[model samples]
Target: MHKRTKSNIAVMLVLALCLSAILAGCGHEPDKPKPTKNVVLISVCSVRADHMSCYGYRRQTTPRLAEFARQCVVYDNAFTQWPKTTPAFCAIMSAKYAHNNGVLRATHGPRLADEHVTLAEVMADAGYQTAAFLSSPALAAHSNIAQGFQNVDEVFVGPRRAVLPTIRAIEWLRKRDPKKPFFIWAHYNNAHYPYRASGIPNPDMFVEDQFYDASRHVRALKDPRAHLKADVPRDHPCVMEILRPDIGAIHTWAVLDERPEELDFYIARYDAGIYSADASIGRLLDELRTLGLLDNTIVALVGDHGESLGDHNYYFEHGRFPYDATAHVPLMIRQPRGAGARHVSTQVAAFDLAPTLLEMTGLTPPEDWDARSLGRLDKDTPGDNLVFTEAGYQLDYMLAVHDSEWKLIDVPNALDRQMMRHQEYELYRWRDDPGETRELSAAHPDQVARLAAILDEWAAPWRAEVYANWTRNQTTIPTETSRQLESLGYVGSNSSEDEEGDDGGD
Candidate 1:
């Protein structure tokens, strides 16, 4: 061959080798037996799963989250182990059920035991900067909640909202090392109570924001006499409130805007909070993109639990009773682009979150974790299993076990609903009767027995031993994971309570 021809042939050979190397690189997964250097866990506190547009709420409280969900795996039947904050997170952070952790209500959340392992500690041990910006007051000071963070930022953001945390986190992200990997827990609590009523501007129509600022009125508080459980006088405050004609107030539905008006106001305010949250999130995402950290990161967004807006007589709150309005929630998962995204509407519980995060970050949870990793679940693979959840009789006492198809609620020795009516219950077939208008314990005896047995068994092995202790003592100090109790005005000077656990034993 001529000299020029030989040179050309050499060039082709080199090009072919280069192409091969790139192809191999593309096929290779991240270093196994080793942690991926970059991942983040951001929790939106007090934001119910159902309140977001992604979860079928009428108002668009979470446009960004909804969009983000498209890029991630969204779980339909996700549920929080415990409804309230401390215990719910105790289960999530430790990957254990409330029963095992001996956590029931707000005060129940003590410092996690030093033996317990957290995703933060896992990432931190694997050489990631494990930091937490506890935005929610629910997990703030005087609690053992910040057990596993190098940056235990329990900074008091005003109103337990996202304003301060958002600002602080953005600043921290900007200052942190780009090459050093990190595990950040950015929590927001703007969606809880007070509903951002003032700045809502328009209760009927408003941007996604935190807390509505609309004025409360009497006319809108009134409902039908039949709707009122008690024989409230015709001129009672609730009756009179619903009859008001004030167009300025958020109380629009004179008929008691359960889902339509009041719920609308609630959603609008949630959006405002989410608006601020989304702005913060967008800023963080932008920073990642600017730092070129976008593609290398894995982000998972989820609710600790859900909220209720008069689905079954429980209005504007949760954990009041065993109802789907407060249990069913949205769970989102987004890996890098080439990683592919699949929507798994199958029955996956939020308890599955810990193991899933661990597995996604290339870490396996301990054998004791009842939760399962989504990394183990195929995209279209049917997760044909019933999820089990229970709350050790704490702030509110009820035994519950549910599947995608149905749920059974047992409110033993309960009658005073609304802090007035007290009664006990053995209810079943909640899926068919969402309002729980019918109690079918007598009808589906076998199902009730099976479900009740599961709840008992789960609570017995994991919870009974510890709960028996709490039931007996009922101390001023809550069960280890009791932030919610503290938030609710439990001002016992028990600084001697157990601290939040930060076990990083490898």
Candidate 2:
């Protein structure tokens, strides 16, 4: 009896132990995740390359960037998703085309769709500390651009708010436990509007903000209409009024066309603004180098969009179609010292920049995303990509896709007989006539047809995005949000775009 009892008790104890082990094993947390790799992306604005020496410009506007470019892969033909800041930045941050994102016009304050995925969120999921020092309202927190950033200092204006981003970024970098990973995007707005570095309180910001005076402002603002002599087609007389407002104060921003000397003066002012931004950036770069984080990180310098500066009958600001001066931007991808070939001429878009950076850091882009990594696409595996851009009214669609030599512009809803927005469509062979003055739609109908087909096919999916984002003020206090978006330079207030005729292309 004692032996039987002992055997039963031993069996019961063994069974209980097995059960406990199974339960405990099931409850045990998986291996602690791998430490995230750190990545820092620095996005600047409107620092035009033609105005800088890096892109073969006569001016010495970008001394700091030139040094960085030595090891970086510089893209000569990197274009923006949209010519305006908000839409363009939306494309860069969200990694989506502008039309699928939102209207990229001034006063356009539509919030990004909640469904849209951001690069920061992707990195954050991979166990990284996401942060952004956004110095521009063009990327306001009012939008979802700041969704994944744990410590985002978006108040990049005023003195108190000014030092915080740089100070905090350096502090975070210094204090960050090496065990954890990091992802930071330091967006600099020093080159944007209200052009005054004197108010910035940093002598290093600009060489001399006080060089130019009110007289320059007054003279440029006078008769702003007279400056629209950029070979605009005869029928497009109204373009002068539609693009640049008669508001006298706007011209002071950039005296592009008034006097040749003003061009020098205006460029000087812009150069000073660049210096201001460069100084701040140089500080951050120094911090990363000091921390020894520079080698492992891929620091990319790119403008969200570009400015016209009186090119092609355009003014200094952007909110138009992708003209050469406004759309073509400077892109420098400085990976580990010898990782990439020195420079590449692969044509890419702003929307693709984020994905490329993510890919370079060994992250996979979402399967449905439209952009591809430029690093992967080299001369050995060169890809001829057709980048699209939009601006102006929805009804005013401009579709441009080029193969190095030929660029075609389809301005649908042209008005006049000679392509002043009268006719339904207009096309131009850019290689034959780089200015795009000739209305060859009627002359060479086949080329126009082929381009139209290409655009229609590419826009089909983006059209679906249009219907999805279209709606009335779903958010309460819509006015303030709209105003914030307007301040960010997105065209139009928060309003549902309902018109069927409103095409998404520009």
Candidate 3:
């Protein structure tokens, strides 16, 4: 009987050890947030930071987002790695440069390669439900922009609206698995070109009604010969009665010379578009709050790129220029339970977004990412402050580097050099001349050489690899996507050495 009692006690001790081992295993993963915590990423296409109310614009273009910005960490000088939609997003999602990620243009471009792990994939692997609602064909599944998203809802149907995607996101959040956290991305194309802000209360606040009088204003293509002129008379009448969805890039610039006041109408329309998008975003935030997810959700807002409103004569376009008009964008992050709500004024790149999201969610970002998390900025970490921007849509390929006060745009393409009167480099003290009106490359030779060397050293390796495999990496756009891009004015003729052609805005 004593022997039997000894064996039972030994079994009890072994059982106790097994129980403790299980409990310790559970406690080891305490760093990861519970499944209740969620993440929401909101991206707006072609939103210029300078045009937003929160950014000090005269008009209240983003009333909803401006209020929302007060509760978030706003990056005032954020720039995109690439100004085009596909390349910009690829850089953001992969934490890599556009050249390295293999997505160079919005259409007829290389898709995001399968090897690059995206943010959605990371969150999904962490047992979070990952989804994306996109309005642009640039982010279509076939383009590989939907790489890591498990559920993707694409709206390619013409007349893109932010509300469509926002509604889809709200619906998905309502029906998501309650046991798992969610990582959702909602991209709005309402701020994109052919700005038609349907449902916006007052989109024409800054413009006179006479500008839209169809009886007086006519929509007609200017003589192809006048495309390059910096100024033309009112007789040219570059203003269009109804801005067609597929208007050419050069035509918009022609408006600057003729019917200049009419530009306000288009600008107002753009602002209205922004306001409409803000409302849709407000609705999404409301849904999150109603569902009791706001307390646990991390919300982030970013612009893929900005639109040029007559900046450097690239009116109402993007992707072709390396100017701040197209490169600077808005970035904001609202942490869970309103933690870390402050403004970060230093320079930040869109590629930094991946690591920022990862670190915020209790996951360690990979050390090799090209950009670092903005958290380092919040903590005043001493790190690289130089931000880079590249352009390869339709114009000559260019590379730009920006420090806190200086910006250098290096246009190395031979065609571009000849076209710009043999001027190959442009240096702007952006803080003083945000318009980039005064070219100072000749005056600031020292600054130009320093930034040019940095850009060349950093880009040489990737540029060589990209050029060598450019043809192989290029993907054929699906038929429907091609149609959508064509309608959106992205599928236009390329510029030639002899004559300035369409800007091929994306």
Candidate 1 stretches greater than 4 Å from native: 1-33, 197-271, 274-276, 379-384, 392-396, 415-439, 471-506
| C-alpha root-mean-square deviation, each candidate | 10.3, 10.8, 8.4
| Higher-ranked by TM-score: 2 or 3 | 3
Point out the higher-scoring one by lDDT: 1 or 2: 2
TM-score of 2: 0.73
TM-score of each: 0.72, 0.73, 0.82
lDDT per prediction? Answer: 0.56, 0.60, 0.72
Candidate 1 per-residue C-alpha lDDT over 99-213 given as tens digits, one digit per residue, 9 for 90 to 100: 6655555442244555667666666777777778775445654445456678877643244344555566667777887767777777765555445422223433463243444
Tell me the lDDT of model 1 at 447.
77
Quickly count the clashes in candidate 3: 0
Model 2 regions more than 4 Å off = 1-36, 159-165, 197-219, 222-261, 379-383, 415-447, 461-506
Model 1 weakest 10-residue run by lDDT: 497-506
lDDT of 1: 0.56
